[model samples]
Target: MAGTHGIHVHGDVEGSQVVVGDHNVVINAALGSSVSVRSEGPPPTRRRTRPAGRALPDRAPQLLGRDRELAALERWLGQGYPVQVYGPPGTGKSVLLRRYAADAATSGRDVVYLPAAGVPAEDLVQELFHACYETENYKPEPARVRRLMGSVRALLVIDDFQGSTAELAELMDAAPGCDVLLATAERHTWDEGRALRLEGLQEEPALALFGEELRRPLRDEEYEAARRLVTAVRGHPLTLVQAAADTTFEVDEDARVTGLANGLSDAASVLLRLLDALSPLPLSAKLLPILAGGVDKAAITELTSLALIGSSGTGYRTTGRVAHLVAERTGPARDAAKLAPALTAWAAATTATRHDIAAEAPVVCHVLAAAAHARDHAAVCALARTTAPALARSLRWGAWHQVLDLGAAAARALGSAADEAYFRQEEEVRKRALGVVALATAGGALAAGGVIGHIAGTAGHGGAAAGKTGFAAAASNPAAITAAVAALVVGGVFAGLATAGDGQPRARPTPSGQVTSLAATGTRPPDPISTAPRPLTRPPSPSRTSPRPPTKATAPPSPTLITSSPPTDPGQGPVSCPLAGGTLTLGAPAGGEATDDYAWQAFKECDDERTLTVDKTDPDHAAFGVTPTSCPKTAHPGQYIPASGPCVYTVRFHPPQSAEPGTQYQAHVIMRDDWGRLSMKVSVYGTVSAASTAGPSSTGPVVTGAACVCSPVRMPRRTQRF
Candidate 1:
């Protein structure tokens, strides 16, 4: 028979209404039409009710540790708004939502509770319509549905909302004014809707729940253990409740719980299997390996939709939880261990090329290392070999240097001829790589120098020479060349060792008969180097002239010269001479005069054989003169004068002079300052004359006067300036 809107019925069609105590039956005659049946089997009868204590309504158990959830639910109900309680499975979310709905209904608020699990999209809508609308003759027209929802302040509670169809998601979006209370195993994201995450009970409340259930306070250690179990299971309410039930509490010693909360994955696995048995499509075999290979939450969600696995989280974890559960049931520790080895093998089998080798090598090595940690030596070796030859070579080097502790045996196992070849090829490439580096370095140096030279307006030839010499030295030393090559190879290899092989060799060094000279013939001579000069010996004195005698009209020469008494022994002190007239009237010298003085004396003594001469003069005197008077009694005193005296007297004795320029000499002179403050002066002058002539042709008489005088013989002017 055909129903309204061309919906066909194969068996029977009943009017949309059904009474509680009626025989409900119908027969259809034609498509798009319905017939009603009048008749009966025994009149419908109500089943016998058990005594009040014997049976209870099939409502969810009383919610524990859900005060916050209930308050939130009541607030939403009062506002006539929808609420979704989302959390991982076993979080007491469904029970809490139900209790809230019941409470709201008791407060005279309209509330409908529906289980969304296994409900078809159409049936779910129908149920919502039936629960909220009071009329028995109602059809689900969109406008009527809207009008009914708009007229009432009602809360619709949906349990297991994640199991609903996409159409339900649409219905939720369309129902603007209707309030909804939803409980889900996972969080839902709906536009303009709020999702309240229902987490597991906190420590205190959870413990209280246990205390209330068990009729005793939980021991400290047992409470701690429960916390750990809860954390491990991510605090799913069902698991904690089960664990609380299974726990044994004692005084002093904490309660001990086993299994359910302790091994969440295992417990969840049991739940998943039950779900799978009920589900129309069983999880796929291929999916298990993928999930076992460390599938994340998003991947798991997609897998769940495909009936590959079951999950709970908002993202990938829908299938992820199921996979974890499966892993737990299969031996969590063993399953976790197996993952690394499987991943290692997969990576090894897949990554074979050298391109992206550095990138791929690290990933492969990580897998291998993880496998090694899991004690899967075969997998480690398999993955290690999959590493590019260049990378393997580096690994060997690392092993040799003790940087990495790939066991010696394993290192030896990994050492292959291919790796050696790859290393040698790398070294060869490095050697060739230097040519470009050398050229670039040379270019950079030249450019830098050119800039500097331009700024200074002078090029440094020496710098150019140094650069050339460096280039030559680098080319000549095999060790230096090898080191450069090694550095480049190592650097580039780490940067990324391309898959391409080394190119063909270029020109080789050859001996040439025609020699090209590098001699710097036209180069400018280097600057002259000089040493500091030594100090001079005798500096020449300035030429001087004697002052002329003063006329009568001129002031009389000052007679202030006062001579000290001569020594008793003539040789002991400076020779003394009496002035020709009273005191000598000396005047200042005409030109630059010598500022210092010295005195001299000569002595003769009669000895047994003959008169022996004892000359006593200033140690610095040039020469000394002596005159002896005829001895009246055969012992006469010698008349002496200073060697450089103004008076020249005949003398029988002579002394030799040294050839050195600065030798000492002594002389006498009458000196005076024109200014009377320093009147007529009497002093001895020491002259260190240039080396004296050995023989004199003629000698002029020495002038003796009070006026100052220079040496008698006039020589060309010899005034010397410093």
Candidate 2:
């Protein structure tokens, strides 16, 4: 005989779970679902209850791409470290934990699955206590909980763990011999614990999984389309599933994007909007809050969960296909404008080296391309202008040109004529300077460079990498030289001087190699009186007669007191600087060096002390091999001229570092006086031939080019009162 009574529990609990205590009890329940109670006399054995709704091990769905994670979890459990599975959303952390829980139950371990999204700590402990002790009321203590958990060999699986990490830590610590597995998108909870970070599946597996979802084998052609679909969703399982399910495996790009975004929460939706607005650029995590307009970690986590954003080591970026979708859905609004100043500031403030620039090129290009496409004129222009210097420093002339073109197009779109013209002019100058491509024949090449310069010339400084003639030879063919000169005139390319400032009035070098002072053109001289030299005069001739008898040798006359220019013989036309006549061949099998002692001495004709400089105003300064150590060292080698006043220089020419077997380098030697005046440009040439095999130190014979004559450059005869 049995008496029936009702037992009531006050607090809310899962309807599927039933509590049983330590006593002999006969209860009729379904075969797969039951709670068996035994008497305390049994050797410390406890009753194991399976919730009515819990799926049997065989009935539970299996997870893909989690084999490694499952094995890792088993290893961690054996080693007694509480394991947490963490990653961006849709990475399958929750599914993995659930799978583990079901497996543990099948293995005879007491399994308690708790969804901890919003549950408080004390409540969680009380619930676990009631579930364990089968009592209505009990004061939960960590020690008691630890002892009780050990007896049952309980395994606690917390899903979507969105509670305080401290609470989670407490539970983990108090569980003693019990194993705790947590699944969370947050990283902090796993900081000191063993964590398995879930990422997307590999290509082959992802496609296979997609095929499995479709319940069919993929055709060969479908493999490529499937691969595109998988890549477009970044190999995310949930995204792949949704994408596959929505379009009947057709994978319409827009529909796939919309489907992926269909069920996002408010925070996630906002994040998606922001990411779309900032399309084509990856931003550092530190700038997220500011650039995303006060978006928080939760929002970013939400987006990451959806696999809309990818995490880089330094920052976050929208996935490529997702970024394209975002750009398509959203126009270039305020967010695009906002990205400009932020990125520009970063480029300016950071000491980003060339390597850094190269590394960040993909991200930079993405942002710039989006901006250009959207016609965000202000943003495009600002970024292009700000990053120009760095690009030039890195020798990225191609990228630099693109930046300028972007600015120009943006300016035109905005109908800002002045801005458009400015950018256009800058572009023209860049093209002229760096874009010079000339044939190797010496007489022809110079003429070719001159003609091209005239056609595309602009008054701006040429960059170091500009005007490169990689290989050239001025063969002693007169017809070739004549043809080259004719080509120069016809090609409309003439080596012209770059203007001093941004089209501002300044002293300029004339074709005759004279400096027309800005003062003469109603502007003040660019240099201060302390630095600029007085006008030059032809020094009087030295007496042909013998020097005064050496009774008391008078100190040598001051260089200024000595007459500078001697009477020109009817034979030689005009006198030239000593550097004019020297030849330097770089890459020659035999190395060579040239020194010009007369570089400084030639300026001693003036009465007042003055500075002499090299005429670096020509855009070809770098092409002509004028550097501080070898020639006049100044900031603007083109404009400032080389060699300080009254200084000597030597140029050592050997094969360029790791020179090719048959390469030639050629350029002119140029110098200037301090009055912003230019001396005649001298020609220097070099060629690299094969090395001699007889000895490592021995080099092959020198291959000479056609002889280049240095004609005396005429200077305006002027007398200075200073």
Candidate 3:
């Protein structure tokens, strides 16, 4: 079916196309003999959105009471600086920037916005290039991109930005003249331009969000109680919206989420528990009933009224606080068997495309993993057959690999060697394709084979750690594979890789790929719930260090709280499970002078003596050094015998000469062990002030209820599975 084009060469690329300088990088190997691009299979598709090049993405959520924040963002962009917006979980970080991006686009500004979850940090530059240029898979040379961006001066907005300092540096390099906005739940200490901390809605905005969610103004008696309820949770928007479910809602200061479910109507109760069962997936309304074995219409309506779940694009999902609390209190629907048949049937249906089920893909992956765990061989086979190819085509290579591995494992359980062989062959094709992607992203630094993580003895997606799922072997004559890979790399395939953030990549599989084998399965770290946040003594300051030229944007942070009582481990089924726990807290403040040192300690959270690394310094103009201190390792530096004894580290911050008066300076450092994230961030005010020419000062909304101890919270990092 492949043919060389005439003068036109009519190159067809399976994915979208981006014209490069004389070289056409083809996606999906649809390249003709003449270097070009084209769709590989007869049918090629994309998400159900407007054409991708610089178009405003369609799924912007409605926001209320954010006028000031929006204005501040507007001012920051006006300053032509990069902005970093940080906050706690579920506080509408994505919503704010998304709203801003849409409005700016309507006004005809060149705006590019992308969500950064589930993507490898290394790929940030590639993704940024794609967004700015509306290119399918290519990242033009950096110098070229910078020059283009300088002239374009477009606003670049990246949501859920969790990249490292280096990743960010690369992105800034590519957009020197543009305003960049980065949002994240956790705080990055590096000097990002114009840092804005987005707090929960104040009383006014809270009421607005509540009234809108309720579809009415507060009743005569409802207003006071709503105020108290908002106060109880510090006006966090997600909580306020959930409370709006009952107009006469009282503050549930002591929230017993499990007990609340019992009070719902019969239909509502079932729906509530079902949603809790699918804890993390964003299930669409269309698929919810199917997954719940045909839930009643009233049940969904009831839950919506309760605000137990909210819309996320085409799907619905529970956010931070609700998700954790529910997962803590409930279990999946009575049995996996009850849901298996229905899910499998849905997957077997041929009506949906990648766009149709994009939001539901993660939900599908979760259930597929469950089916394999339940030994529902037939169901696993059915789901994999439909989902794998679609996943691969959408660049969800990680999930596709796992789905195939799960399918092959199911085939083995069903005693079908043929299916297993078929999956392995497809994997070889995937590995070679990945080599091209990895090499292109790496700018040809990596050996082709290094890109394939599932090589024989490495970690396998569906199988054990013994590497049962990778291609059988590297081709004996490497020339053909190398040349082909080289062609794909040179002819240009998608230059960047895209992993599904919500795609629910399969649980890390074991040697046998048996879901039932707990030891064999690898699970991602759970985000612990913080129902009662411990207040810090000092007023919570929203972190904002102005970047020299660019700025960024926000996400919600959940610093772990040590529960007085152990949370009922849902997996234990009625048993109160005791678990080992601790907290990481302050050591000593950094000395005022450039070389003056400071310290922080880990009470009981330190795991095997980890070293501290300076993640970033505000303004990055100053010098800061961090190292594991011999003393002050036991607790907060203040609590120890000597301020620096037995706990954290002795570090120092020296502001860069360019650091000006009236502007504050800060240093951020982080550490991680087996349990969760550990970090220390400190601030030192410039001694002399009054002059304000060099640095950025807050022009955004005043952070309401900003008194929060910005703690080192759980930071989620992704592992490449393909």
Candidate 4:
């Protein structure tokens, strides 16, 4: 039986029996082989063949915009790994899988394509098993099916596999080593596979598809309309294919298509109905508006299960199919309106929980009057007041302000005067909040004196405060007043001693025993008598005198000469003397060391001589008077070097005053080194004022000098020696 190519048998044959029944003959019987002639049953009915011109439906490579997906399928096929392709409908998952399978078959690889959609689970398993074992007109048993699956180097493509049930799991488990490609409208629950999500075709691909299928170039306007339609439909291949087939553009004599491509609304309706049929739940007329609120991924997935929406990866959108069906049967506008009251009621009831109500209501209300008519005062107010603060705190200032305005308006409309009063009271709370901020700022200022400049500049210069009024007001509170007093005390302690009359202009004393004359050559001089006097001094000059005196017969009148010389130093004791020159330069020994502490005490001397006296009478003055009269080799105590001036003086002996001595008759001078070490004192002296000698000269020396002469000398411009 296995060797015979063409023969018929009517009865069961045992061994090699050749049996002829009614219209036949029997031949050789044994030999384990026999040539049997048997009457054949009536010829089987033949299938009618197509005419010469007709051919079998040729399924060409259908893949579009799926090159990457095909490559992935090839990789999985090579590895004998099962792969599941998933995405929203119209992404061409099935087409891609089938095309890959065809390509593999053309490359000498065996492939079996199965459509799982609507097929019974048992039947699908059976068909898969048959494809695995049977080949080239051979029948396969269950054992052969199992063995074939283990060894076969072929791929199986399952299209629309989302409908597969648990029964199909056995077939999957049996073909663990065999390659399987699954195409589904949604991701599957299969455990032993990787899922590749497919995105919708892009605009360029869609346009190419349109051009290829339509066999004509789309006009500019038609192309634009197509693009809009495709984008709105998320470039869904199925929808684009339908739209491309249905739409046509032609240029008339006026260069316009007779009718423009349909609007999105029209196309959306058709897609909508298809989606409805594919949905898990029967979408009632009630839920359409809610789904349309925003056709995002989450919304689409939700509505898809409810039979109200569909989407592709370009993004979820309303369907023209559903829109049109409703329009054709239930008056487009009227059917759409039916959703209004229900959506409005839903919105109103759910407003308290829906954070997005404000954003959604306006659009929903446009389609459904009930949305506008529904009262949501509480919701609006809650959004405005509570949410606004949260937004502000989150630093969404613009959004916070918008929400506040919205809430304020809602509150005004829905709330009574009492509500307004409550808000006004809340304003006080806000002010108090501002006060807290101000207090914090103040505390910072107190911690760091740098903020003092800002505060003083504001208060003293009358600039506006940095913080809000409440903060400023809080800073001005009684607590702040005490703080201010404490700060003032602290500042005063740091500022040092401030003398009351120190900055005032007053008369200065002159050196004691100082004689000044307005008639003296050079600049006129000032009085040197007052306690705080200011005196002027001049350069030394030799006295003018005649060289001879007549002596022969008559006695020459006694010559009287006014002689001027440097003041005399009276040893270690304070000395008093009249000044001759307008200037006096006290020269101390180069390195003379003295412990003499001295302070000048000016007193009115002879008035006619316009003389004043400086005496170191007290112990303090004596202590300051011990400077060496002659130059010495050692360092001398510092002296008060008075401005160049003629002055009278009284000398006394005392120890040098310590540093920071005030009102001590002795001099106190301290010098610091760059390294902060103390250095030996240099000679220094105090100045004294004298009476003016600018007017008509009197008998005695006129005192005060001209302003320029009495004033302190202008420092000379020193040349740069380098």
Range of the 10 consecutive residues with the lowest summed lDDT in candidate 1: 713-722
Count of residue pairs whose backbone atoms collide, per candidate: 19, 29, 59, 90
Per-residue lDDT over 231-341 for candidate 1, one digit per residue giving the tens place of the 0 to 100 score: 554434444444454453321112222232243443344334433332322222323343254334454433343322433211112222333334344332332224444
Model 4 misplacement above 4 A: 1-58, 132-145, 248-722
Best by lDDT: 3
User: On a 0 to 100 scale, what is the lDDT of residue 546 in model 4?
Assistant: 21
Between 2 and 3, whose lDDT is larger?
Answer: 3
The total of clashing pairs for model 1 equals: 19
Give the alpha-carbon lDDT of every model: 0.33, 0.43, 0.45, 0.33
Q: What is the C-alpha RMSD of each candidate to the true structure, in Å?
A: 50.9, 35.1, 19.6, 46.9
- Residue-level error in angstroms, candidate 3, position 170: 9.1
Q: What is the lDDT of residue 172 in candidate 2?
A: 55
Pick by TM-score: which candidate is best?
3
Candidate 2 per-residue lDDT over residues 1-722, each given as its tens digit: 11112111111112322222222122221211222322321113233453222232222386766677677677545434457776555556666776778777766666766655334454355445545654322232233344454444467777656545445644554544456677666543221235565666767778877887776888897888888776655566766764554434544556656655665666666666666555434565655664566757776775665456755435665654543454344433244544666667666655655435533444454567668877687887777666654443333344556666777788888888877876675565444322221111232233222222211211112211121111112223445545544543222211112222211111221221111221110012222112222222312112112222212121112113212223224342222221112223344353432222222222112111222222233222232334433232333222211123322343333544465655454443434432322332333444555555211212211111111111121121111111
- Alpha carbon lDDT at 306, candidate 3: 64
For candidate 2, report its TM-score.
Answer: 0.31
Worst 10 contiguous positions by lDDT, candidate 4: 705-714
